[model samples]
Target: MKTLRLGPWPAIATLVLSAVTLAGCDDDDDDDTPSDSELATEALLRISRDAPTELPDNVPEDLRRVTFGGTQYDLLELLGRPSGSRPSARIVAAYQTVDTPADPPPLGTPSNAVLPDYTRSAPAAQVYECRQTGGVFAWAFLQPEAGLEPMTTTPVPGLETLGFDHFRYPGGIDYGPPTGTPPVGPAWRVSALALNGGEPTFGQTLFVGAADVTVPNGAGNVPLLRLSNAARIDQGLPSDVFSRTTSDGTQVGYVLRLDTVGGVAPTAGCAGAGDVGKRERVPYSAGYYFVEVLTPP
Candidate 1:
């Protein structure tokens, strides 16, 4: 199981940036504090400094399996994609050659399900409350508390975090059922962590509907879920904004909760009316795939 300690981290990020920039400078008396980009890079390096480089034989080369800082992300479900899965975004498919048509269909799994925009590792809790539903007492799912860490790829093995920075978010997974409730509708209060020049940056808040597709993972773990995006929360930002902003990633599509570990509500916890207000926080960790569209824009 993966573990993460959640708390306020601005001070920590600032300290990291200070220490790194100070150590690198000798007497260059221009700028002491690092840029937002530099600070972001340092934070990303610190978090993923301990991931194992080697992957199991079962994992595909197209994907990554990271075990960093005791949080192992074996995205087992994404390993060997189906034959229907393709690399083309729906936009490209929509513009199929009426004038200059390809002799063959574009390469890869042909399904509308293209690869993810990027993946993240979230060690979260599936909060549940014993509420009366259908006149019976049961454990109803509440919101999820998690911190998202962007997964990055390195051209060289040992130099993974050197050039890449995966920003960390002290955030939560806000959920509401697909019927579209008013109060708790947004799916993720968590900042969208998107990559900028190999550095992960925080973007806007993501809105999504709950569980459009649900697949049972196991007896002891939470079910895999697909939460479709509700809006284009982060869109039309300037490319030049990447350097100035802490994050500039557009996130308005789908969120897949694949490769789950735990967080099952107790089957026997709520027995009667007496247990109506009981609460439980089942611990879980999942590999989250964030997709912009059926294909990238």
Candidate 2:
């Protein structure tokens, strides 16, 4: 069979643009760590000039096997084709699991009520990144809309096993311990869903207040956003919350974003700064930092 080369696709860029708009920062200020409100206000303050670049020759080949440390070409060979593209960061190959019901089930419904009737849906897409050494593999990511999946009687190493619906690099690997469940109260909710309605999209209005947070417990040592005055316990906001699973099976939820000051630089003890690690301290004079409260489960 002839390999199918993917044409330039903009979906990834759209996703990045939407994300960057939320997390874009202004370096004019020299503050080491700015307040969340300050960053939020600044995010609104700075006008992002990054228009989506013109599409490139983003093509793909037939993917036979996907392995860690494989080249981008190797990935094309395994996944069969590329579905989306971003310049140097990554390429995406999308697979449609099946025609999902217009609505699967209201999130937060009783597991017994929904799980039995629910058919697993394929993740919208698989993101792949190329390494300096010319290898490409599935890149991990967090989806704010992905509802928290509680572990069954048997706990799995990776969160994906529970049908959490987030992306991970090297596939089937958990960053740390799995998040079970979190304490019930002290959560935040959206006053209004979004300007256009439907689940809130990026650049939409986000009204946050202390409410019951519904997402699954986030992994520890992950980068998170927090208000300057927020509590420092549990590594504070923007770091790790619900870092571990409780004996009773509860998962904690925390805010996470893909952008930061210095444009996702490398961190100590992290393979790449992009890897969700510990609370990322904005370097001195790094300017205003922006964060997005992860979407409710």
Candidate 3:
């Protein structure tokens, strides 16, 4: 079968604009009515933007093949054609590990999840703090820490390469964690090298709060999360931490942590007084998709 490329995104946008114009020309008697062209264009736009770049003919084993419907996706593998572009299904299923409970919370997608603007993979550590939970002891989540590199997107030479002193309390206003509270939350940053022979700087910083929704990943693996961020997560906002951001996630509305592997905390160690304050970072990996934006030309 012959493929249709539809030129570039710019051309697609032009088509969508034309469709909107057509919608505006609907009969005045029914101003709310949408023209057929407008409806068709909207559907086409979604299809063209979201269709998988490649089908999931052979799912990699170590990618922690746990998805949110949520189960083994042999059917996806069976239906997928390896050599063709499938502008229909979002072939990359969902993420949440094996350890998720049998009667788990309903699975959900990230807010405003249409099609991602960029997807990056990260091999990371889910940092945990061993502490007393009421009377019993357990491993509590401290943060999901990772040094992000290119996963699904091509590496840009100067995209962001900088030193972010997560420990540095801005302007010497120390809250006194020794490292000064580490900016108040789990953070994701993109750093870029300087072009004009200056020091490298952070391009974007995402400080995310607790998950708005979650899905079980699998046995002995951490759960996948759709963390919320209305551009920024915390209220009052960390002046010291986010002040340096250039984009402030203007292009990125929200992010998805999918296709996970590993990162589950050990249950054995956090069982007693001796384990108090002990920290561990279980190795894990996930694909992160940063989604949709209103970009100006």
Candidate 4:
């Protein structure tokens, strides 16, 4: 089984952005500190921030065998025959379950934050891709629960949660989900560390896309490997995107280029002026797209 590592929580920004100051609300009330509403919002935001990005570490023993490097036989053995699969690409499998459990797990106590009910069954699909070295597993893309609006209520300490309700934040004051459709849904999402050899290298919200990472043929180009540049831009990292097919031609994904960043070397086998690195295939779907970060030399 592949081990996942949870990164330490970086400092979080306050979630309360309302300009309404408690200036004259009650001069008699001298506790100038933030109100319960503000506290509650900040606490919830913190809880969301601290939540895990990959599947729970304690996934039931029955479901634990299904991982990125596991095979199709292993997946079928655990998940049973999938609800649907692609004929062209038998490597892809889709499972429909009414019992999809809450993700990110409920933040039990102290923080006092709770996810809205209804999330237990909010996830409708679980898709997995079978690749050579990576085996059969879903690419860590996050999808929000469709049509489920964020509800406001008194936050509770422990309530079940799902990835959809969890935001894909990219650091800074705006600690929330991306504005447009995210690359992967809640059921299929994975963490940045999960992709980086289980080591925490990027921010909590960074979506790591690999070059030549392919998806099983689905309804459309389901980009199993992808990333978002918003956070990189925010951090002053090189924002130019590029792509290249894996040597075997079995996968296609994106990679970031730091052409302007000094000390970067040219890619082997790839020779083109300013092409720095070959570009990889992108999903047809419209949304924020990015590539994996290249280690600086």
- Give the candidate number with the greatest TM-score: 1
Q: Rank the candidates by TM-score, best first.
A: 1, 3, 4, 2
TM-score against native, each model: 0.45, 0.16, 0.44, 0.23
TM-score of 3: 0.44
lDDT of 4 by residue, 1-297 (tens): 111122432222211113112211345455555543333333334334332222223222332222222332232232233322321111111111232344433211123323322335443222222222223222223322221121223343322221222222222233233323223212122121111222232212223232233333234334232222222111111111112122333332232111111111222323333332232221122112221111111
Q: Which stretches of candidate 3 lie over 4 Å from their true place?
A: 1-123, 152-183, 195-204, 207-210, 232-252, 293-297
How does model 2 fare in lDDT? 0.22
lDDT (Cα, tens digit) per residue for candidate 1, span 1-297: 111222443454445444434444555566554444344334343333322222234323223332324544333332233422432111100000011111111111122211111122433466678899788788987656554444334321222222211111212222223212222332332221222322232322233444566777789888766655443222211111111111233222344566677889878879888889877766677655543322212
Pairwise TM-score winner, candidates 1 and 2: 1
Candidate 2 residues 128-171, lDDT tens each? 22222224222332211221232122332222111112211111
Q: Give the range of the ten consecutive residues with the poorest summed lDDT in model 1.
A: 90-99
lDDT of 3 at 143: 64
TM-score of 2: 0.16
In angstroms, give how far residue 288 of model 4 lies from its true place. Answer: 16
Better of 1 and 2 by lDDT: 1
lDDT for each of the candidates?
0.38, 0.22, 0.38, 0.25
Model 1, position 21, has a per-residue lDDT of 46
